[model samples]
Each structure stands twice: as structure tokens, then as C-alpha cells.
Target: MTGKFIVIEGLEGAGKTTAINTVARILNQHNIDDLQFTREPGGTPIAEALRHIIKNGLDNEPLTDKAELLMLYAARIQLIDNVIKPALKAGKWVIGDRHDLSTQAYQGGGRQLDKTFMVTLKEQVLGNFKPDLTLYLDIDPEIGLMRARTRGELDRIEQQSLPFFERVRQCYLEIAKQDRTIITIDAGKSIDDVTKQIEQILTKWLTKQV
Candidate 1:
């Protein structure tokens, strides 16, 4: 049987990390063998290092939307070739905490990066690497930002203004509209409620596939 690729996507503080962890635990309890959980920009050393640099806002000059888009894809190439693909080949279910959807949302919607440019990059650089399922955690930008701020230090990206976050949220919604494989979840709900919903969705999908 082929391995399944599932991705969890959301803005910062949308509870993506918690959701992914909960889902992983559920899968383990069910004896779903050969499962691996990872996050983007870094799943391996090189990609993770790149993630740190980008997240920390290391680039001296103002990071243009185009530059940010390219960096994201750069990390994606490394992640897919080195981590995701290899794990899939080994018949493992790879659950990514985030994926290309982030690039399209943050770069395209948030930064006003061109969609045409993203498509071009996807075709040439990313190739056939696509998630089987994408779980989008939908939350209002204001609430998300407040939660993020309350949590602690904000990353360069997270520190972006409210308008930027609004754009990002819109991007996520747009992607959900465009793709059938994407599932939108109301992240405004309580964490347990959100986890239950995700588990139900995963169970249904896994049952069908298996």
C-alpha cells in the first residue's frame, strides 16, 4: 500500500502544533504503524537551519515577497527530497505540520506575491510532491494574533502587522476553496473539540484509504 501524506496548516497560534501532536497520538493508539510527524522549513538539519534564519528575520534588507517565496520553496525542495519522499518510500505515513500551502498563503496572499510565479516555481522546483490531505485550521486573524502574542516571543513572520495576518487568513480560505483535498476546521473551537474533529476526519480518510 502507498503511504499517505497529511499536512496540518494554520496561522501562528492556530494550534497546529497541538493538533498534530494529538493526531499522532491517536494514530499510535490505533496501532497505525509506520507513521512520522514533521514540520516545514526544517525536518532535517539544513532545512531547519534555513527555517531558523528565515523565521528570525536574518536577512539584512527588507525581505521582499518574492525572496520570501523563493526561500520557502528552497526549504521545500530539501524537505521533500531528503525527508518526506524517503519516508513515504519506506511506507510510512508522513504527517507534516505545514507544507506548500503556507507559501501560497503567506507569499501570495499575505505578501501579494504573484500566483503565476508560485505556479511556475511549483512546476519546476517542487514537481510531484503534494500532500494527500491538508487540514486547514481556520481562525480569525485578530484572535490568532492575540493568542500568539500571549504565548510569548513572536517570529519575524508572526510579528507582521494585523493587515498581513488578514491577508494570510484570506489566502488559506482561498486555497480551501480551490482545492478539494483541503479540509477546513474551525480552530476557534476549544482544543479538545478541534482534536476530536480532526480525529474523526482522519479516521474517515484512513479507513477509506486502507
Candidate 2:
């Protein structure tokens, strides 16, 4: 059986991890085998090390916009080649916490990176492995930051200023507008409500697409 690749996208603290976990439970309930869940920039060993450099600090005091964008693509290529594509090929339902949208939002949106550069990199690096379904969790940046703050220590990216998050959210909206494969979900709702909505959406998609 062919597999469905479902990717969950959102700004920082948009409850994406919760949604991913919920989707995993839903798929497991249906006896779906080989269900694979992963996050960008960290799916494989080498990519994970890169993620650490991006998320934490490895050597540089400040990372340039171009470097940030390039690193994201590098991690993406590694993830797609090593983990995501293979899982789909083996008939596994793949649920990803985040994917290319993060690059568009973080690099293109947040950092004001070059749009043409991103497009070119995506074409050259990603080729044809786009997600079958991309779920975008929408939430206000302020609310998201508060939620993240309540969790624990903030990472480098998470500690970014409000303006940065605003840019990221706007980019996400633009992405949703441009990509028909993406579905937007309000992330401000209670956990149960958000899960219910996701379940309904996934159930509907599975019923029709599968």
C-alpha cells in the first residue's frame, strides 16, 4: 500500500508537537503500520547535529541570513533523502512536525532572506518530495510566545523578538494562500478542540484520498 505523508507546520509554540502526537495516535488506532513521525533539521544523525548548530551555538556568535537559509535547506535535503522519502516509499504514513514551510517562514519571512534564492534552492534541493498534506497551525505570535515561555527555557530561535515572529506568521499566511495542499487550523483553541478538528480533517482526507 502506498503511504500518505502528512506534514504539520506552524510558528514557534503553535502546538504542532501536540498535533503530531495526536495524529500518530489516530493512525495507530487504524492499525496503520510503519507510521513514521519526524521533525525537520533533525531527522537523521548528521542533520540533527546541524540542527544543534542552528538551534544552539556551535562556533559563530551571529549567523548571517544567507547562512541560516542555506543550513535549513541542507538539513532538508538530508532529511528528505535519508528519512522522509524512504518511509513513504516503504508504505509508511509519515507525520512531520515541520518542513519546508519553516524555511520559507523563518528564512524568507523572519530573516528577510532573498525570495528568489529560496525558490531556486527549493527546486534544486527538494525536487518532488512535497508533502501530500500540510497542516498549518495558525496562532498569534504573542500567544505563541506566552505558551512557549510557559514551557521551559527558550531556545535561540524561540527567543527571537516579536517582530521576527510577526514576520514568520505573515509568511505562513502567504504560504497558505499560495499552496493549495495546505490546510489552516486555528491554534488558539483548547487542546481537545484542536485535536478534534485535526481528527475530522484527517478522517475526511483519508476517506476521500485513500
Candidate 3:
């Protein structure tokens, strides 16, 4: 049997890392031992290189919007082919930090790229592949940015204007609204509270799956 693919999505500083760990713990409690964890734009060797370019601005010039979008897809496909697909086929669960939703939010919404075009690219690149479940942590852009700043220096994508992340957050909400597989969680709450909510959601979903 093919294993399930789970993804966690959110804006910067939305506690995705913490959420991922929480999910892993929940899965472990259910005896789901064979698992793999991946992060977008950097899950494999080639993907990691592309991730560096995408996250670090080139010295000569800023990366073009179109180029950034394509690179994300390229890295994603590489990770899929080399890592995620194989693990799933081998019956190992794959937990992902970020996925195609990020493209929809960042490039399509924030950059104001054509949504139709973004959908077209997604279809071409991913076809029918999608996460079995996506946990989306929703937070205000200002609060998220403040938390991000406390972490360290912001990366290229993290350095985007407040308006950009606002648009991104809106896109995430809109997409989550239409997708049953995507569960939205209020990430502004305390870590323990967020963890409790996530466990409830995951437990309920797993009960149905079983």
C-alpha cells in the first residue's frame, strides 16, 4: 500500500517547524514508524542548491519573479522524484514542510501573478499528486513578521514587504476555504494550545481514514 503524504503550510514564523514536530509525535503515538520529513526548495542535493539561490539574493541582481516561480517548481519536482515518491511507494509516510500552496500564496498572490497561469504550472508539474492532508497555520502578517525577525536575519523571501505577506496570508485562507484536505489552525495562540488543536484535527482525520 502507498503511504500517506502530509504537509504543513504557513507564512513565515507561523510555527510550522513546531507543528511538524507535533505532527510527527502524534503519528508516532499511532505507531506510524516508517516516516520521512522534507522541506520545500531543499529536500535533496540539487534542490538544496536551488534553495540557496532562491533564498539568497544573487550578488549581481535580484532574481526575477518568473525565475523564482520556476525554480520552486524545479526544486519541488526534484524532491518528488528523488525522495518523496520513492518513500511513498515504499509505504513510508512523508511529512512535508511547505508545498505547492506556498507557490499559490507567494508567487500567485503576493507577486500578483496570474492565478490561472499558476494553476497551469501546477497541473503540468504535479499532475494529480497532492497531499493527503495539509495543516495550515494562520497568523497575522505583522505578528508573524515580528516573530520571524526575532529568529534572525530574514532571507530573500522573508524580506518581502508587509503587503506581500498580507496578500500571501489572504491567498492561504482563500485556498484553505475550498479544500477539505487543508485544515486551518489559528497559530496566534500559545504553542500548547496550537498543539492541542492540531492533535484534535489529526486524530479526527485519522479516525476517518482508518
- How much is 80 displaced in model 3, in angstroms? 0.7
Off by over 4 Å in 1: none
Give the winner by TM-score: 3
Each candidate: how many clashes?
Answer: 0, 0, 0
lDDT of 2 by residue, 2-118 (tens): 888899999778999899988888777777767888888789888898899889866667877787778888888888888888888888889988999888898889989778988
lDDT by residue for model 3 (81-155), tens: 999999999999999999999989999889999878888999999999999999999999999999999999999
Count: clashes, candidate 2: 0
TM-score of each: 0.94, 0.96, 0.98
Q: After superposition, how far is residue 109 of candidate 3 from its true place, in Å?
A: 0.7
- RMSD of each candidate relative to the true structure: 1.4, 1.2, 0.9
Q: What TM-score should be assigned to candidate 2?
A: 0.96
lDDT (Cα, tens digit) per residue for candidate 1, span 61-174 = 676667777777888898898888899998898999899999888888888877787899988997776899999999998898889999899888998888998999998998
- In candidate 3, stretches whose alpha carbon ends up further than 4 angstroms from where it belongs are none
Candidate 3: residue 18 lDDT (0-100) = 97
Candidate 2: clashing pairs of residues: none
Best by lDDT: 3
